[model samples]
Target: MTISAFQDYLNEHRDRLLADLVEACSIPSVSGQMDACEQMAAWVEARLQRLGASVTRWETEGGPPIIWGVLGEGSASILSYSHYDVQPADPLDLWQSPPFEPSVREGKLYARGVSDDKGDLMARIHAVEMYQALHGTLPLVFKFFVEGEEEVGSPHLAPVAQAHADELKSDGCLWEAGEVDEHGRYTMYLGVKGIQYLELRVRGADTDLHSAYAPMVINPAWRLVQALNTIKAPDDRITIDGFMEHVRPPTPAEEALVERIPFDGQALRSRWGLRSWLNDMDDREALRQFVFAPTCTICGLRSGFIDAGTKTVLPSQAFVKLDFRLVPDLTPELVVELLRAHLDRRGFHDIEIVPLSSLSSSKADPESPFVRKVIAVATEVYGHEPVVYPSHGGSGPMYPLASGLGMDSVTVGVGYTGSNLHAPNENIRLEDYFNNVLFLARLLQSYAGA
Candidate 1:
């Protein structure tokens, strides 16, 4: 089938497609909200059914449902993964419009989930429909694996993938999200880093103490600060004993790829309101560290007397949330073990380690057939050559379903650098949405022919 015919169909139904996306985004399917998540899943199930897909809704034990849909029939099949859940739109005052109320301004659609996953999900659906309408039948089988718990670290996806291995296997998988960089080059990622999110707690006195007792009382807040300092050094390197030994260095090929990546450090610094990157590294070093190095990040910290007013009370207990972004060979269990031992050796056994959630890192060969095909199709669609990343800095549940299954996955979506993902006024450009539909249509055709 001709690509223009598919593009024409999408153009003709552009209004309806936008309406569908707006409807999908209107549901505030925040990750932990059971009612909203269920409603969104039902809506997706019905929409898939209407598009002639045989849908199966798998109910999770404590998490939301996993909507699996299969459509068309052919020897070749493609698995597409997306999520219906969104990050909580907290600090609502920052939003110009209600987070659940979809609004478009200056050619961009704004909503909490508009850019993260819903936009990518709806664009793929529209592409499939457009392809079928133009060709009279789907060229290959297409599977939709939309989950409702991705925003919460996809806590249930690994087990679900194991249970449905036979059905979930595919020739290749298209990951949830991607973006066109500020330089107009579409970006594709082959894998993601791993995550170990945890918390450290310390308790001293039974209750808050007066300033007069500060010299006698062991302040938990001070203990937390000392413990945090031990994890990272002044040079911005992880100082957790034995933690760096597990971080697998990038291969020669991976290092070469990073060198070729177009990283505008000045632009990034300006956007972040920073004078320089970590350790005042240049573009090449900064990009290398970003893609290959594991990190110890302090996500949040809390204790008493954090309010606006000043109080002379000393906090009895203190806690801090930390996330360790792991590279290859560094598993979450290993991190926890290393951290516990490190703290014990430092005589900080009074501090407690609370492991929250984790996901292992995943990577795919950038030169694989499926990956090359995606790069080729993206080049043809976007005109400019696509910027390929061997692995993204962010972490996701890509390991269990993609790498663990011995299948390669690549990320492709309809977002731009300006898309305020996980923040207020999250949005995507209208033009990018249409372009992504066309890109997906062409990708389907190309993969089917191959």
Candidate 2:
């Protein structure tokens, strides 16, 4: 489609398109919320049906169901991976308006999942609709794997993927869309880092005791803190005992691709109200670390009397939640095993390790035909060379569907630096959203067109 025709289409259907997106985003389909998630599954299944695809709903072991749909037909197929579920809208007061209520202001749409997955999902569907309206039939077959548990680490996806590996097989997979950076340049990521989320707990006495007894009693909080201190140093390095041994280093090709990525560390630091990045690494080096380094981050810590007011009470129990970001060859199971051994060696075997969730990392070959075509098409459509990353710092369930099924994957999206994903006031530029729809439509046409 020509630029003029694209503009004309937008002019003719902008309001209705935005309305449809807003309607989908209005569903409180927060992941891990069983009741609301069930509602989202039903709505998503109906949406796919409306698109004229035969849909299948697979219920997760104990979470939301995975909605799979397929349409069009050809030897070449692209599996679209997206999530109907969203992160919980906590700290509600931080939002300018209600998160579920899509708010448009200053040429941006503010909603919880607008920039993350919903906008991308809707844009892809819009592209499908617009493509069919203009081209009659899709150039290649398309499969949809819109799951309802992506926001929660996709714990149940592995089982489903193993059970239906044949159905999910595809020529290439279109993972979630990547974001435009702070510089307003389009970006693409070939892979995502995996994650191992676990909690560490320590116990002292069975009940809380008076502070006066602190001299005689051992405080579980101190013990937990000490154990955590061993995991990371003040220099921000993940000193997890023997954990770094498993992280696979970047290949020469990966290094070359990563070097091309723009690094505006100062801009990011300014936006985050900071003076310097961790360890004061230069912007480029910090960017490399962000992508390549494995991390043992303490997400949360809780113990005694930690409230609005001060209370001198000895805690019986202490807990610290940690998330370990894994690169290639470093599975969640390995990290857990190493951590247990490390703690045991350090004489802290009493501390229990409770795993919450995990997803393993997978990367696509930069020179793959799929990656090359995506790069070429993105350049043609976006009017600029796209910045490519070998791996995104974020973790997702892409492994089960991408490389696990023997296909490469990439991200294409409408997010900008200020999208605030997983934070309050998440948003996407209205212009970017429309532009992505056009790009996706072009992408659909750029294939072999057999």
Candidate 3:
């Protein structure tokens, strides 16, 4: 199929597609909120049904429904992965308008879930519709594994994936994450880093004490500071033993792909308000660290007060939120065990480590046939060579489809860089959304033939 023909299809049916997406985007499907979660699952199921796919709402014990759909018949199936949930629109006051009320401004749609997985899901569905409209049937068989608990770490996902692994088998899977960079160039992430999140709390006295008693009473804030120091030193290297044992070094091909990734390190640092990365690293080194190296970060720390002024009270309890980015072969359970063991050895066992959530790292061969097909289609439709990466810095459940199912999965979406994902005023460019529909359509057509 010609790119012009696909573009024509998008132009002809753009209004209907946007309307459907707008309706879906209006739902505040924050995964943490159960009601909106179920609503979105049903919405997706209904959309898939309308697209003539046999739909199933796979209910889990405590998680949101996993909407499944199938179309056409082929031994080699394309497993399309996406989520129907979003992060909570906290700090709601920062939003330009209400988070749930979808609004179109300056050729961009503004809402919490607009540019996130919702827009992505709509683009995939629209692509399928475009193919069916052009041809009586899709070029190849496909299925969707849309989950609602992605925002909440997908705790119950592996269980469901394990249970339905046979039925969900496919030649490959394309999990949804986000779209290209700010320049509209096609971007693909083959993998993502694993994560281990925890909260460390230290108890001091039975109750809050005045600062005058500091000499006699122990301060939990100081205790937390000392404990955090043990995990990561001034040089920023994590001190947890065996933390780097399972880390797999990048392959030669992966290294070559990293060199090809055009990242303006200075620009990125400026955008994120960083003076410079640790060790004064250059572009290649910084980029390598971003994709390959593991890290320990202090997300937040809660302790004594200084709000509006200083009311001196030694807080009885202090908590520190921490996250450890793990490389390949580094399981979350292993990282947690190492941290616990280190703390116990260091005599800080009193400091509790409450586990939060974790997502595994994944890496797909950069030159795999499926990956090449994705690149070819993206280049043809977008009129630019796609940016190829061995893995992504962010963590998502992309591992299950690629590493779990042994498929060369890739991620591309309508999401624009600096879309403020998971933050207030999340949105997508109007043109990006339009082009995304054409991209997916061409990809489906090309892959089917491949």
Candidate with maximal TM-score:
1
**Candidate 2 segments exceeding 4 Å error:** 1-8, 32-36, 90-98, 208-219, 305-315
* lDDT at residue 313 of model 3 (Cα atoms): 98
- Tens-digit lDDT track of model 1 for 196-306: 999999998899988679898899999999999999999998999999898887887677678778889898889889998778888888888878889999999998798
TM-score of 2: 0.90
lDDT of predicted model 1: 0.90
* Residue range 296-321, candidate 2, lDDT tens digits: 88899999997798888999999999
Q: Where does the lowest 10-residue lDDT sum fall in candidate 2? A: 1-10
TM-scores, all models, native as reference:
0.92, 0.90, 0.92
- Our tally of clashes for model 2 stands at 4
lDDT values, one for every candidate = 0.90, 0.87, 0.84
Question: With candidate 3 superimposed using the best TM-score fit, by how many Å does residue 419's alpha carbon deviate from the native?
Answer: 2.5
For lDDT, the strongest prediction is: 1
